[model samples]
Target chain A: GAGVSQSPSNKVTEKGKDVELRCDPISGHTALYWYRQSLGQGLEFLIYFQGNSAPDKSGLPSDRFSAERTGGSVSTLTIQRTQQEDSAVYLCASSLLLAGGLDTQYFGPGTRLTVL
Target chain B: AQRVTQPEKLLSVFKGAPVELKCNYSYSGSPELFWYVQYSRQRLQLLLRHISRESIKGFTADLNKGETSFHLKKPFAQEEDSAMYYCALSGLANFNKFYFGSGTKLNVKP
Candidate 1:
């Protein structure tokens, strides 16, 4: 893709429902990241993926929040039994991740989830 | 834990006035800070980073390790500069996961 692309640009689900968000990163980017942003709040770290390495899942808020990346290209974020508090914008980013600490993240348009 | 904080939520300035967006971070090891801007209805994009030490769109941010600050500055503000700006930090253990500040809304009046 030309840039980091996210799917389901807007999702409105009832409480206790499950929702899935998708991200397709820029071609050949080695690092991918997921983040959550509440209305009028800063983005919160969620998860990270780097090539074929095991993903760093430390940032997942809870067990309900899980993400998987396949073939190191596309990633999906799943939220089970979503709560009202789960409503927020989910963002995805990808970086070249070559210069050790010089990784610059480019973000997607973000998915806006509204839990009613 | 690595944390990024942007103290001001809203800032209004006239065109051609000086503007500064304050950002502070707390991390135990070496710190990498970045500034991202989101124009109206546009995706969030990287503006600048501490490592690059380069200015983009006439905006620059300098990392002050002693003060734990990475404030973004511009000598003269333009109407196009009106947008939401975020400060981010990446740490050693976070696998390049960037921690973003609450964000500051810069409004430039014509």
Candidate 2:
């Protein structure tokens, strides 16, 4: 892809249901990131995947949220037992991890998830 | 603790007016800071980074360790510059984990 792409631009799910958001990062990018943007709260980092190393999941808000990057190209964010508070925009970004810490993340159009 | 903070939710400026978007971060060690902008209906894109210390589209930001701030500024605003701006930080403590502040929407009116 020319840029980071996200699937299902919008998702409406009932409370307690599970939702999955997908991201396809640019080819050859070594780093991928997931973030959640909501009212009051800013863009919150959820997880990061870089070249097969253990994902940095320190930013995940809770245990219900999890993500996996397959083949280092596509990534999926799964929110289990979704609650109303889960309503927000899920953004995915990718970057070429440079040697000089000059990574400039390119973000996707984001998936707007609404849990009712 | 919230690593990044963007104090203004919205900033309205007239065309040709000076503009400034405030951002602050809290980190013990040196952190990488960046400014990202999202145009209407477009994906978020990097506007600039403190590391590069370069200006883009006439906008610039300086990392102030003394004040713990990285404020985006432009001498004159253009209507096309109206967009959502986010300040971000990547810290050594959470290497590769980037933290973003609540974005400030800049509305440059004609």
**Candidate 1 to native Cα RMSD, angstroms:** 1.5
Model 2 residue B43 lDDT score: 85
Query: Which runs of model 1 end up more than 4 angstroms from their true locations?
Result: A52-54, A100-102, B92-94
Clashing pairs in 2: none
lDDT of 1 by residue, B1-110 (tens): 67898999999999999999999999888777889999999999999988788999999999999899999999999999999999988764355467899999999999
* Model 1 residue B78 CA deviation in Å: 0.5
Error of 2 at B34 (Å): 0.6
TM-score of each: 0.95, 0.94
Q: Per-residue lDDT for A1-116 in model 2, tens only?
A: 49899998999999999999999999988888898999766788888889655456778898999898889899999999999988999999988877765467889999999999
Instruction: State the TM-score for model 1.
Output: 0.95
Every model's DockQ: 0.70, 0.68
Give the chain A TM-score for each candidate.
0.93, 0.93
